[model samples]
Target chain A: MNALPAHVDIREVGPRDGFQNEPETISTAAKIDLINRLARTGLRRIEVASFVRPDVIPQLSDGVEVLQGIDVPDDVSLMVLVPNSKGLDNALRIRETFSEVAIFVSASETHNKRNVNRTIAESMADNEIIAKRIVAEDLRCAAVIATSYGCPFEGTVPLRHTLDIAEQFAAAGAVEIGFGDTTGMANPAYVGEFFTAALERLPGVEVTAHFHNTRGQGLANAYAALQVGCTSFESSFGELGGCPVPAGSTGNIASEDLISMFHEMGVATGVDLDAVIDAARAAQTVLGRKLTSHSIIAGPIDWSPTADAPSCR
Target chain B: MNALPAHVDIREVGPRDGFQNEPETISTAAKIDLINRLARTGLRRIEVASFVRPDVIPQLSDGVEVLQGIDVPDDVSLMVLVPNSKGLDNALRIRETFSEVAIFVSASETHNKRNVNRTIAESMADNEIIAKRIVAEDLRCAAVIATSYGCPFEGTVPLRHTLDIAEQFAAAGAVEIGFGDTTGMANPAYVGEFFTAALERLPGVEVTAHFHNTRGQGLANAYAALQVGCTSFESSFGELGGCPVPAGSTGNIASEDLISMFHEMGVATGVDLDAVIDAARAAQTVLGRKLTSHSIIAGPIDWSPTADAPSCR
Candidate 1:
C-alpha cells in the first residue's frame, strides 16, 4: 500500500553470475553474444564476467576475452566482478574497458571462508585496499556484501554486522554498495526493513539489491526494497546461475520477470521485456536446456480484448 | 510496508483443481490418500473434489468415490465444486459429508461459454437458485467468479464489472465469494485496489482470492491481497492445476509457497509447514512427476546457525 517508485534501475548479471555457475564451460564468444544481446535490450548495466581464479570457477575463465569481445553501447555500463587484489589487478589491466568493478565478501564468516578461503577481517582488509585503488584509478566501484539478508551457515545475520560492513565499505571510498541475498533467504518484510536501515545508515550512496529466486521470493523481495526507495537491482536473464548445493534451487531472479512486474505496476525500468525474453531464449539455446523464468515461459499478459480464451490446464 | 494480517485462512484446493488438470487420471484411492494427508496438515478448509461432468474433467470422475473415501477430521471443512443443478443433485445425495459447496461462473462471457456452455447471465441465474438451495440445506455456499482479475479472452476486465458481479453473488445468498486470477494476469496494484473496492461494496462477505501462477505472480498477488486485509486464500499443493491453454504455464500458487511466505513474515496459517510439504511430496509421487512449488524442491530455508552452506548450482 506504499507509493511505488516512479522508476527503477536494473543491472543484468546473467553473463557473469548466470554463466559462472553452469557445469559446462561457456565460450567467450557465446558469453559475448549473450551480453551483446542483453545490452541491446535496453539494459544499461550488465555484469559481463568475474575475475575469479580460472581454476576455481572455470565457467567464467575467459573474463578478459568476454569483456573485450562484447560490443557494448556507450550508454550501457559493463561491470566485472573482482574477488580480491589479484582479481582487481586483472580488472585494472583493462581498466578503461569496464565501467565499474565489484568486490564481494560474505556477511557470514563461514560463508566468506568457504567461498573465498578468507576471514571477514582479511577480506575486508583486502577490499579496503582494492576499493581505495579502484577509486584512485577513477573507475566506479562497489563493495558487495554477500549473504546480507541471511546466511546458510550463520542463519539470521546480526543487523549491526551488515550495516557495520557497509559503513566500512563506504569509508574505504567505495561509491556504491550491494547487499546480496546470495542464498535466497530474504523475505519481503525483512527486505523492506533491511534496505530502509541500509539507506538511512549510508546516505548519498548507490545501494543495489541482489536477490536469488532459489526460494521463489526474489521478485517479492525486490518489490519490498523498491517500496523502501531502493531503486537499483541485480538479476540474471532466464533465471540462470542456480545454486548447486540445494539441488533444485533456482538462481537469480530473471531479468524479464523483474522488468515485467515493474512495468505492470506502472514503475519504469527502461528495459524491454520482449527483448530480454529474446536474450533469455538465446541463453537457453546456448545452455541446451530450459531455464526457470515465469515471464519467459508465460509471455506477457495479453491485454487484447478479443484474444483467444486460455485453455484449462 | 503495510502491516500483514496476523492470521490467514488457507483453503487447500489441490485434490480438486490440481488433480483435475493433470493429463493422467489418479486412482480414487490415491486421491483419497492425498486428501487424507492434507486434511491432517491443519488445513481447516479443503476443496476435496469437483462434481462436474465426468466427460469434461475425467481426471476427477471419481469425485463421489473420493468424497466417500476420505476420513476428514472434526475441525476440517470439506468443500466440493458443483458445476450445475445435476452436480448439486449429486452432491446433495451425500450433503452431510461436505461442509460447503461452490458454484462457479466466469467474469468473461466467452470463458463461461467455453467452460460450462452458458452465458454469464444464465450461469448467474442458475447460481442464485443453487446458492439458495445450498443455504437451505444448511451448507455454506460460495460463488466463484473466475477471471475476476483479467479474462484471457477479453483482457483487462473493468473493475466496475467485477465488483458488480461480486454484488450479485452476495445478493444471491452466497455467503462467500472467490475472485480468481484465472490466467495469472492480476498485478499487485490492481489486486490491492480491486479487493479494497470489493470488500467495501460487499460488506460482511467472506471474500477469497484464487490465483494461478501462470506468470509467477500468484504469491505476489496473494501478498497484495493480504496487505489489503483479505486473509482467506485458495492454493493447491505442489502448485497443481497448471493452465493448459497457455503452453508452459504453471498452476496455482503452491500451498506451501504461500504458507512459507506468510510464516516467514510472522503470520499464522495454523497449517503445518512440513506437513503441507509432505503432502506436496506425496502428490508428486502419486503424479509421478516433479512439481513447480519452490518449497517442495528447495525444502525450507534452514535457520540453524551451524547448518551446511548451500552449494552453487
Candidate 2:
C-alpha cells in the first residue's frame, strides 16, 4: 500500500490547461513567469503550453514565445498538447525546446465530434498516426483519454468502452494512459471502481487520474484513486479550465489544492506545497478574479484559518 | 456494509435549537404551528422547546405556552431541553404533555463553564439527578453530550474523556444518548473514529451524531459516521442553532441536506425527503431569512441546480 503506483505525479497543467480557458488574453511574460514559478516548485512534469491554432485559444497564442522565454530546467519533463496535425506541426518546429508532446482522444463519439470534429474511431486512428510520428521523431507520446469516467452528453461512459480505448492507446505504444473525468461527475466510489478495473485490465500502462472539482467532490475522488493505487494525477494550478460542455464552468481540479491534501495526508506528491500556492496566487492576479483553489485562500490544512484571506461574497 | 442505519431518527431541534438563538420573541402560535407542521411530516421525535429561565434563554420564554398549544401525537416522542433543577421543575410541569426530555452536558470543562456556567462534574451531577427524575416520572431521557467532536474554548476532547462522560449517562440510566459537534469543528475523520470508539466502549447505548456545517464539512462528516454504522442523526430543519462561542455564525447541519445525501447514497433514513425540503422552504416565511441548507434553495441534488443558494455574505 505504501509503495502505491507511481507516487501521485501532479502533472502541472495550469499554464496550458488553465490559461486556455480564460477569455482574457494574458501577456507573454506572464505565461512564461507562471511556468518558471511552477518549475521552481519541484513539479517534475508539466504541460507548459499548447500549440493550438492562434485564432482558436487566443490566450495561449504566445505558446512559442512563452517556451523560448522561460528558463525551464532540463530535469523537468515539459510537454504540450497537440490537437491535430497542424498543432503537431507547430510542436515539431519547437520540438527541440521540450521533452514530450501529448495527444488527446475522446472516448465518447459525441465529445470527440464536438472536441476536434472527429468520431471516436477517427480520433483513435489520428492519435495512432500522431503517436507513431512523435515516436519516430525521438519523442515520447502520452495518450490523454478524455471522458473516461463520464460524458456530459451521455450520462456515464461504459467501463468497457473506456477500457477498450485505453487498451488501444497502450497497444499503440503510449508511454502513459491518463483517464479524464471531463464533466467532474466522478465520485470516490466510481474512482475506486474505474481504477481498480483499469489496474486489473491494463497492467502494463501507467494510469493517471485527472478530475474536476465542479461538484466539490474532486479531492475525495482523487483520494479514492490513491486508495486503489494510482500514483499520477493531472490538475490545473488554480482549478482553472472551463468545461466544454457546461458553459461558463471549470474542468480540472486545482494542483495547489490536490498537493495540499496529499501533503496533509502524509502522502508524497513531490511538489513544493507553499510554492504551488504562491504560483496559483500569481495565476489569480493574471486571471483578474479570484479562482476556486482552496489552498490559495484557506492556506494549508495545517495552517489554522486566520481571519485573513478576504472572505468571498 | 450497505445496510445503512434504517430510520435515522432526526430529532427535529428546530423549535428548541432554532428559536433559542434568535433575539426577537416569536409568538406562541408560530411555535405551535411550526411543531404541528413538523409532526405531520412523519417526524417521530421533535425537540419542541426548552425549559429555562427567561433571563437565560429569552427566546424560549413561552416554552410552557408552546407545549400546551401544540397537539402532541401519542406515538411521536416530544422532547424538551432542561438546564438545571429550576428548568427541571418547569419541564416536570409539562411532563404530562410530552413523553421525552433531553438533558445536555458538555464534554469539555471550559465549554461547560461558557455554555451553562458549570464544570463537567457539576453538570454530570445535575444531569444524573434529572436523569433519575425523568425515569421516575416514566418519561424517556436522552442525555446529549455537547461538544463531543471538539470544543471552541478547549480544542479536541480526547476519545477517553468523551466515552467516560457517555458511560456516566448510561450508568445514570439514560435510554438514548446524543453527541453534539457544538463548535462545528467535527470533520468526517473525527466523526468516524469517535463513533467507532464510542460503540466499542459503550456497547448498546444508542448514539446520535449532531454536527454543524460551519466549515462545509458537516454533511460529509455525517456520511462518514454512517460508514462506521452510527445512524441516528439530529439536524435542525434549517441550520438553526447558535454557537455561544462564535456569535453570529452557523450552528447545525441542514437537515434537508442530510436527508438528500442519505437518500442519494441509498441509505434508508425513513425521512420523507421531499417533505423535509418543503418544511425548510416553509420556514423561510416563518423565520424570515434565507436558509443555510443547500437543498432548500438549490432544490434536491438530483434536481439540477438552475439557481445557486446565496453565499453567506
Candidate 3:
C-alpha cells in the first residue's frame, strides 16, 4: 500500500447517527451541547443532523432547529443527511451555516425498499434531484451508499452494484462517495480487495468508510481500507447507533475507539484524543447509559496503575 | 497471501484452555463429556489436560484421571502440559496412553517468573530438560511461549526476546513453537507482520497462534496469522480467560466465535458450526451464566431471514 495521506478526516456522527437509533427523545439543547462538545475536540467534520421528517425519525425531528441554533465553527465543516430534495432544500436553507451536505442512496435493492420505501432505482433517481440542490448551494455533495458491502435483507451486494451507485452519484454531481457497511458482513480482506478494485473502476473518487461494529470487524475493515489507501472514515462517539439489522447489534465503530487505533498506529488524525473521550463521556450522561466503547471504559492507551480509577459513569 | 491451506489443524484445548478459567469444578464426568463431544467434532489434535499441580489449578488437577478415562479415538492425538519433570513424570506414567506432551515457557523475563515461577534463563534451562525427556519418551513436544506480543508489566516485548525463545525451542528439538499473545495486545497487522518476520527468522518452525481478545482484536489477529500462513490457533470456549494485563478483562475470543467467522468466510476449518454453537450454548449452561459470544447471541450467518431456515443453535 502507498504511504497514508497527510491527515485522516474523522467525521463525528454522534448527534445524528448516535441518537437516531435510540428509542428516546433527546432535547434540542442537549443535542446542541453535543455538537458544540464534538467541535471542541478538534474534529474537522461532524455529521450534525438529518433532515428526515419528525414522524419518521422522532430523535432528529429538530434537525432544522438544531441547524439554526448550534454555534458553527469557521474551519470545521458541518454535514447533515438529506433524504431527498425536500430534505436537501431544508439542508440548503441552512446551507450558509454548514460546510458540506451529504445525501444517501441504499445500494441493496431490499434495503432500499425497507429503508426509504423506494426501489434501488428510485433512490438513485432521488439523488439526482438532491444533488442539484446541493450543487446550486455551492456545497460539497457526498453520496453515501448504505449496505455497500452486504445487506441485512439482501445477503451480498455485488461490487458492480455499489460502483454503479457511485457512478450514478458522480453523474449527479456528487464530489465524493462514502460506503456504509450497514450490516457488519464486510470483512477486512473483502473490503481491502474491493476498495482496490473500486479505485480502479472509478478513478479520483474520494471514498469514506462508514462501518458498524455489529460483528466487531469495523476497525479491522477500516484498517484494511486504509491499507488500500482510503483514509476518510466516519465513526460515532461511544459507538451509539447500533446495528439496525434484525439483531439490534452494535453500531458504527466507536469514534473514541477508532481515533485511539489511528493514533496508536502513528497516523496523524489531528483529533484531540482527550477531548474526544470527554465528549463521549458526556454523551453517556445524556443517554443515561454506558456505551459500548472500549476506550471510554478502559481509558486511553496510556491508562494504568489506577486502572481502577473511580468510574466516570 | 496465497490460498489458505486445504486442511488446517485445530487443537481442541477446551478441556485445558476452556476449563481452567471456569469457576467450577466441572465434574470429571462433565470434563470427560466435553472431551467426548469434541473428539466427535473431527478435531485431530486436542490438548486433553494440563499436568499442573492440583492445588494450583484445581480445575484440571484430575488431569490424569480425565485423560485416562475419556473414550478417545486413536486418530485424535492427546496432549497435556508438563510444567516440570513432575508434570512430565505424570505424563510419562501415562505415556502409553497419551501421544504428545506440551511444555510452557515465557518469552518475557517477568512473565516467565509470574507464570511458571521461573526466570527467563531458568525457563530455557527447564526447556532443555523437558524437551530431552519428551523426545526420549517417544512423545511430541510443543513449546508454548507465553506473552510473546506484549507483557502486562513490561509492555511491548522486544522482537529479539520472542525470537530467542523460538531459537531455544528449535534447538531443544521442539516439534512446534506455539506463540501465545498471553497479554492480548496483538493486532492483525501486528500478527501478520510479526509472523511474516518470524517465518523468515525461524524457517520450518510449526507455529500456533494463541490470542486473547482483551481488546476485541483476537479473531482479527488470528485471521492475520492465518493469512501469513500460520494455521493452528488456540481459543477458549465461551471466551473465557482473564487477561493478566487488563484486570478483570475477558479475552480468549470464544472458540465458536472464531469458528463462526471462518465458516462464514467459506474457510474450511472442518468444524461443524452448528455443533460448535451447540457446544458453546452447552458451555453457557454449564457455566450457569450468559457468556459474551457475538456468534452465540447474534446466532450465525444463516441467522438472516434471506438465508435458509435457521439451523439448530
Candidate 4:
C-alpha cells in the first residue's frame, strides 16, 4: 500500500451542515457557542453556517447573527455556504468577518436541480459570478461539488462528469474544491481512485474529501482517500447531517471519529481529539439528543493498560 | 495503494461470540434457526458455539444443544471455540460434529489474566496441549491471540508477544491463527503493519483479522488488513459481540458491514449480501432489539438510480 499523508486538514462542518438537518431548531446562541468551542479545538477551518433561504432552511436562518456572534480565532478560517447571488451578497456584506465562502452544485443534474432549484449549468454560472466576487473580496472561495461520488437520484456518477464540473470551478478561480459524498454512497476503492484522479487532474487546488457514515464506510473511505494523498477532509461534529430525503441516512462521518482515526494512525490533523470530543458532547447537549459519534460514545482507546476502565455509561 | 485481494474468506463468529455477549439467552431453536439461515448466506466457516462454562456466559449455555440441533451443510465447516481442556473435552464429545475447534490467549498478560483468570504462559501451555489433541482427532485447530493490537487492561501489546503466540500455535500443528482487537483499539496503519509482519513470519498459516467496532475503525482496519494481503476475517452478524468487561464496547465489526465494504470494493467474499441482511434482520427479530450493523440499517447503496427508495424505516 502507498504511504499515508503526514498531515491532514480537518474542515469542521457541523455548525452548518449538521444543524441544518437537525429536527429541532438550534438557537443562534447555541450555534455560536458550538462554533467557538470548535475553534478552540484546533480546528483551523469551520463551515460555521449556511446563508440559504430562511424558508428552506429555517434552522440556519440566523446565519448572519451567528457570524456576528462567534469569536473566531485569528488562526481559524471561518467558512459559510452560499447558494446564489443573494446568499453571496449577504456573505459579501460581512466578507471581512469570515475567511472563506463556499458555493455548491450537485454533480448530477437531477440532484442539483432538486437541491437548489437550478440546473447545474445555471448553478455553475451563478458560482462563476460568486466565485469571482468572493475572490475579489479577498476571501478564499471554495466550490463544493456535491454528490461527487454518487447521486441519490442518479447512482454512480461518472468520474468524467465530476471532473468537468471541477474543471469549471477551477477555472472560475476557486482556490479549494471539495467533493462531497452527499448521501454517503462512496466506497473505498471508488474513493481512492476518485481522489487520486481528482488530485492528479486538479493540481495545486486544495482537494477535500467529504464523506457520510450512512453505510458505515466513512472512515474506510477517508483512509482510502488519505492513501491516495487527499489531505483535506470535511466532517460534522457528533455525526450530524444525514440525507434529508432518505430520512434515516446517517450524518457526515463524525469529525471526532475521523480525527480519532487519523490521530491513532499518527496522521497529524491539527484538530485536538479530546477537545473535539468535548465539542461533540456539548453538541449532544445542545441538540437534546444522543450523538452517533463513536469517539463520543466509546472514548479514545485507552492505550494505558494500567489506567482505570473507561466509564462507558 | 496495493490492489485488494480478489476473494476473501469470512468466518462467521456471531453464533458463538455474539450470543455470549448478549444480555438475554437465545433459545436453542432460535440459535439453530439463525445458524441455518447464516449457512445459506454463503459463509463457509461458522463458529456455532463456544464450550465455555454455562454460568460464565449463560447466553451461549446451549452450545451442546445448538451443536446437535443445527443442520450442517456439506460445503460448510462448523467451528466452535474451546477455552481449555475441559471445554475441548466437551467439544470432542461431538468431535465428528465440528470441523474446527479454537483456543485463545490474550497478547497482553494483564488482559489474559483478567479475561481467562490465567497467565499468558499458562494459556499458551493449555493451547499447546489442546491443539495437539484437536489435531490428533483430525480436526483443524485455530489459536486466537486476543488483543493483538492493544489491550483494554495493558494497552498497546508488543508485536513480539502476538508473533510468539502465533508461532507457538503453528508449531502446535494449528492451521489457522486469528489476531483479535478485543477492545477495538486497532488503527489501520498498525493493522497493515502487524498483519504484513504476521503473514511474513507465519508464512503458511491462514492469518485471520478480527476487530470490534468499539471505536468505529473496524472496517477501516479490515481494509488495512486486506491491503497487506490477509484475506480471512472473523466478524459477527448484527455486530453482536463486544468486550463484556468494557460496559458499552460495541460488538465485532458487523459481518454485514464488512461484507458490504468488500463487495463494494469488488473483492468477492462469496457471501450473499441480501441473504446476510435477511439473516441480520431475522437476528434483530429474535433478539427483539435494534442491531448495530450499518448495512442492516441503511441497506446497500443501490447502484440503479431507477430502483425504488430503500424503506429505511
Candidate 5:
C-alpha cells in the first residue's frame, strides 16, 4: 500500500446534507446548536446549510436562520450549498455568514437532470457562472461532482466523464473538487484508481472524497483514498444524509467513524473523536431515533490508564 | 496499494460464534437450516457448532444435533469449535459429522484466564493435546488466537506474542491459524503490519483474519488484510458474534458485506451474494429484530438492464 498522509482535512456536512434528507423538519435552533457543537470539535470546515427553496426542501427551510445564528471559532470555515445562480444570490445577501460556497453537478446526465431538472451541460454552464461569481466575491468556491463513482440511474459511470466535469470546474476557478459516492456504490479498488487519475488530471485542486455507508464500504473506500494520498474528506455526524430517492439507502459515512479510523491509523485529523460523538448523540436525541453510527453505540477506544485492565471478552 | 488476490477463501463462523452470543436459544432445526443455507452460498467452510458445556452456553448446547442435522454440498467443510480435550472428545464421538475442529486461546494472559478460567500456558497445553487428537483422527485442525490484535483487558498485544502463539499452533499439526480482533481495537495500519509479519512467519498455514465491528473498523481491517495478501477470513452473517463482555460492542463484519466488497473490487469469493443475503434475511427473521448488515438494507448493486435509469438521488 502507498504511504498514508500524516494529516487530512475533514469538512462536516451534517447540517446541510444530513438534515435535508430527514422526513421531519429540524428546528433552526437545533441546526445552529449542532453546527456550533461540530465547529468546536476541531473541524475546520462545516457546511451549515443549503440555499435550496423552502418549498422544495421544507426540512432546511430555516437555512438562512441557521447560517445567521451559528457562532464558531475563527478558524472554522463555514460553508453553504448553493444549487444555482438564484441560490447563490440568496446566500450572497448574507455574505458574511459563511466563508465558502459550494456548487454541485452530477457526473451522469440522468442523475443531473433528475436532481436539478437540468441536463449535465446546462448544470455545468450554470455552475461555471456560479463558480466565477463566488470567486469574484472573494470567498472560497468548492465544486462537488455527485455520482462520481457510479450512478443509481446509470450504473458504471466512466471515469473520463467524471474527470471531464472536474476539469471544467477546476478551469472555472474552483479551489476544491469533491467526488461524491452519492449512493455508496464505490469500492476501494475503484476508489484507488479514480483518485489516482483525478489527482493527476487536476493539479493544485483540493481533491476531496465524499462517501456513504449505504452498503458499508464507506470507511474502506476512505482508507483506499488515503492510501493514494487524497487528504480532504466530507462526512456527516450520526451517519445521516441518505439519498432520498433510494428507499433503503443509508447515510454518509459517519464523521465520528471516519475520525476514529484516521486516529487509529495514526493519521491526524485535528478532530476530537469524543466531541464529535457527543454531537452525534445530540443528533440522535434531536431526531428521536437511533442513528446508524457505530461509534455512537460503542464509544471511542477507552485510552484511560484505568481502562487498560478491562475484563476479558 | 498492493494488488489484491484474485480469489479468497471465507469461513462462515456465525453458527458457533454468533449463536453462542445470542440472548435467545435457537432451535437445533433453525441452526441446521441456516447452516444448510450458508453451505449452498459457495462458502466452503462453516463453523457449525461448539462443544462448550450446555450450562455455560445454552444457546449452542445442541451442537451435536446441529452437526448431525445439517445437509450440505460435498465441497463444503463443516467445522466445530472445541475448547479442550473434553470438548474434542465429545466432538470425536460424532467424528463423521464434521471435517474440521478449531481450538482457541487468547494471546493475553488476563483474557485467557477471564474467558475460559485458565492461564495462557494451561490453554496452550490443552490445545496442544487437542490438536494432536484431531490430527491423529485425520481431521483438519484450526487454531484461533483471540485478542490477537488488542486485548480488552491488556491493551496493544505485541505482534510477537500473538505470532508466537500462531507458531506454536502451526507446529502442533494445525492447518490454519486465525488472528482475532476480539474487541475491535485493531487499526488498519496495525493490521497491515501484523499480517505482513504473520504471513512471513507462518509459511504453510492458512492465516485467517477475524475482526469485530465493535468500533466500526471491521471492514477496514479486512481490507487491510486483503491488501497484505492475506486471503483467508472468518465472518458472521447479519453481523452477528460480538464480544459479550464489552457492554456496547457490535458484531463481526457481516459476511454479505465482505463478499459484496470483494465482488465489487473484482476479487472473487466464490460466494453467491444474493444467496448469502437471503441467509442474512433469514437470520433477521429468526432473531426477530433488525440486524446491522448494510447489504441487507440496500441490497446488492442492481446490475440489470432496466436498473440503468434509476431516479436521481
Candidate 6:
C-alpha cells in the first residue's frame, strides 16, 4: 500500500451543492444558520451559496441572503458557485460576503449541454472569461469539471477531455480545479490513475477530488486520491447534494464520514469530527428526514477503555 | 497505487451472519429461499447457518431445516458457524449438509468473554479441538477472529494479538483465517499493514477480510486489504449483520456494494452483479424495510447507450 499524505484539506459544499438539489425549499434563515454552524467546525473553507438564476434553482434562490447572513472567523474562506457571466456579476455585487468564486463546466458535451444549455466549447469560453474576471477582482477562482470520471449519457469519458479543461482553467488563472464524479461512476483504480496524471499536468494548481456516494465508492475513490498525493477535497455535510437530473445520483460523500476515515487513517484534516457531526444532525433536523451520512448515525469510533462491549457473533 | 489482484473470491454470509443479527425472526422458508438464490449467483461459498443455541439466536434456529432445504449446484460450498464443542457436535449431527465449519474467538479478552463467556485461551482451546475434528472428518475448517482491528471494550487491539490467533488457527489445521472488523473500527492504513503482515506470516492459509460498515469505512478498508494482495472477503447482502451488543455497530459491508466496487475497478469476482442485486432486493422485501446497501438502491451503473440521462447539476 502507498503512504497517504500526512494532512489534507476539506471544503464543505453542503450549504450550496446540497441545498440546491432538495425539492423542499430550505428557508434562508435555516441555510444561514447551517452555514454559520459549519464555518465554526474547524473547516477553513465552506461553499455558502450558488449565484445561479433564482428561477432555475429556487432552493438556492436565497443565495444573497445566505451569503449576507453567514458569519465566520478570519481564517475561514467562503466560496460561492457562479454559473455564468450573469451569475458572476450577481456574486460580485456581494463581493464582501465571500472570498472565492467557483465556476463549473461538464467534461462531457451532452452533460454540458443539458446542464447549461451550451456546448462544452461554449461553457469553457464563458468560464475562461469568468475565471479571469474573478482573478482580476483579487478573489480566488476555482474551476470544477463535472462528469470528470464518466458521464451518464456518454458512458466512459476520455481522460484527456477532463485534463484539457483543467489545463484551460489553470491557464485562466484558476487557483484550484475540482474533478467531480457527478454520477458516482468513478472506481478507485481510475481515480488513482486520474490524479497521478492530473498532478503532473497542473504543476501549481490545486487538484480537488469531489466524489459522490451514489454507488458507495466515494470514500474508496477519495482514498485513491490521497494515495496519489492529491490533498484537496470537496464534500457535503450529511451526504447532502445529489444531481437532481439523475434519479439515483444522490449524496455527496458525507463530510463527517470522510473526516472520520481521514482521522482514523491518521491523516490530519484540522476539522472537529464531533462538531461537523452535530452540524449534520442540525441539517437532518431542518430537513425533517434522515440523511445518508454514516458518521452522523454511528458517530466517531469510541476508543476509550470504558466503551461498550460489542456483541460477539 | 499498489496493484490489486486481477481475480478475487467472495463468500456470501448474509444467511448466517446477517439473519442471526436481525431482531425479527426470519422464517425458515425465507432463509432457505434466499440461500438457494445466492448459490446461483456465482458465489462458490455461502455460510448458511450457525450452530449456536436457539435461545441465543432464535432467528437462525432452523439451521438443520435450511441446510436440508437449500438446493445448490455442485460447485457451491455450504459453511456453518460453530460456537464450541457442543455447537460442533450439533453441526456434526448433519455433517453432510455443509462442507465447511467456522469457529471464532475475539482478539480482545473483554470482547471474547462478553461474546462467548470464555477467556481467549479457553475459546482457542475449544476451537483447536473443533478445527482438528472437522478436518479429520474430511471437512474444511475456517477460523474467524472477531475484533481483529479494535475492540469496543479494550480499544486499539494489538495487531500481534490477531496475528497470533491466526497462527493458532493455522497450527490447528484451519484452511482459512478471517480478520473481522467486528465493531467497524478498522481503518484503511491499519488494514493495509495488517494484511501485509498476515499474508507473510500465514503462507498457505487463505486470508479473508470481514468488515462492518459501522463507520462507513468498510469498502475503504477492503480496498486496502486488496492493495496488499488479500483476495478473499466475506460480506452480507443488503449490508446486513451487525454487532447486536454494541449500539450503532450495525451493517456488514453489503455484498452488492463491495462487488460493485470490484467490478468497476476491473476486478472479476465471478458473481453476477445483477443476480446478487436481485437477491439483495429479495432480502429487503423479506425484511420489510429498506436495506443500507447503496448498489441495491442505485443498481449497477447502467452502461448501455440507451441508459437514462442523468440530471445536470
- RMSD per prediction, one decimal? 1.5, 6.1, 3.9, 2.1, 1.4, 1.3
**What's the residue-level lDDT of B244 in candidate 1?**
42
Residue-wise C-alpha lDDT for candidate 4, range A1-313, written one tens digit per residue:
6778899999999888888888789988889889899999999999988888898889999988999889977999999989889998888787777888898888988887777778999989988998999888888989899889887777889998999999999999998999988777888988888988999999889999988887778899999899889999999988888563356657589898898899999999887788999999999998788777778878776776475554210
lDDT of 5 by residue, B1-313 (tens): 5688999999998998899888899888888899999999999989988898889889999988888888999999999998888898899899999899999999988788878989998888888888998999999999999989877666778899999999999888999999988878888888999999999999999999998887677888999999999999999998887574356557788999999999999899999999999999999999999888888888888644353444445
TM-score each candidate.
0.97, 0.75, 0.90, 0.97, 0.98, 0.98
Candidate 5's displacement at residue B49, Å, is 0.5
TM-score ranking, high to low = 6, 5, 1, 4, 3, 2
Clashing pairs counted in every model: 6, 1, 0, 3, 2, 2
Ranking by DockQ: 1, 6, 5, 4, 3, 2
Which residue pairs collide, candidate 4? A305-B153, A305-B155, B241-B251
Residue-wise C-alpha lDDT for candidate 3, range A1-313, written one tens digit per residue = 2444556888998888888888789899988998888898889899888888878888899888888888856888998888887887677766677878888878877677777889978878888988877887788888888888877666778898789889888888888799888767777768877888777776776878888776556776777787677878999998888464535567778888788767756677999988898999998998898677766765554523222322100
Identify the candidate with maximal lDDT.
6
Global CA lDDT computed for model 6: 0.89
TM-score per candidate for chain A alone? 0.97, 0.92, 0.93, 0.96, 0.97, 0.97
| Winner of 2 and 4 under lDDT | 4
Stretches of candidate 5 exceeding 4 Å from the true structure:
A303-313, B305-312
Give the clashing pairs for model 5. A153-B308, A153-B310
Give the per-residue lDDT digits (tens) of candidate 6, residues B182-209.
Answer: 8889988899999999999999999999
Ten residues in sequence with the least summed lDDT for candidate 4 chain B: B304-313
lDDT of 2 by residue, A1-313 (tens): 2233445787998888778777788889888888999998999898988888887788888888988888877788899889877889888888888877888888767767767888888888888888888888889788888878766555557889998998888787787888887765566656777888988888877788887654445665776687678888888887777353344344677787677656644578788888988998898888789775545664543323232321110
| lDDT string, candidate 6, A119-165, tens digits | 98998888889999999999999999999999888888999879999
* Descending-lDDT candidate ranking: 6, 5, 4, 1, 3, 2
lDDT of 5 by residue, A146-214 (tens): 989988777889999999999999999899999998877899999999999999999999999999887
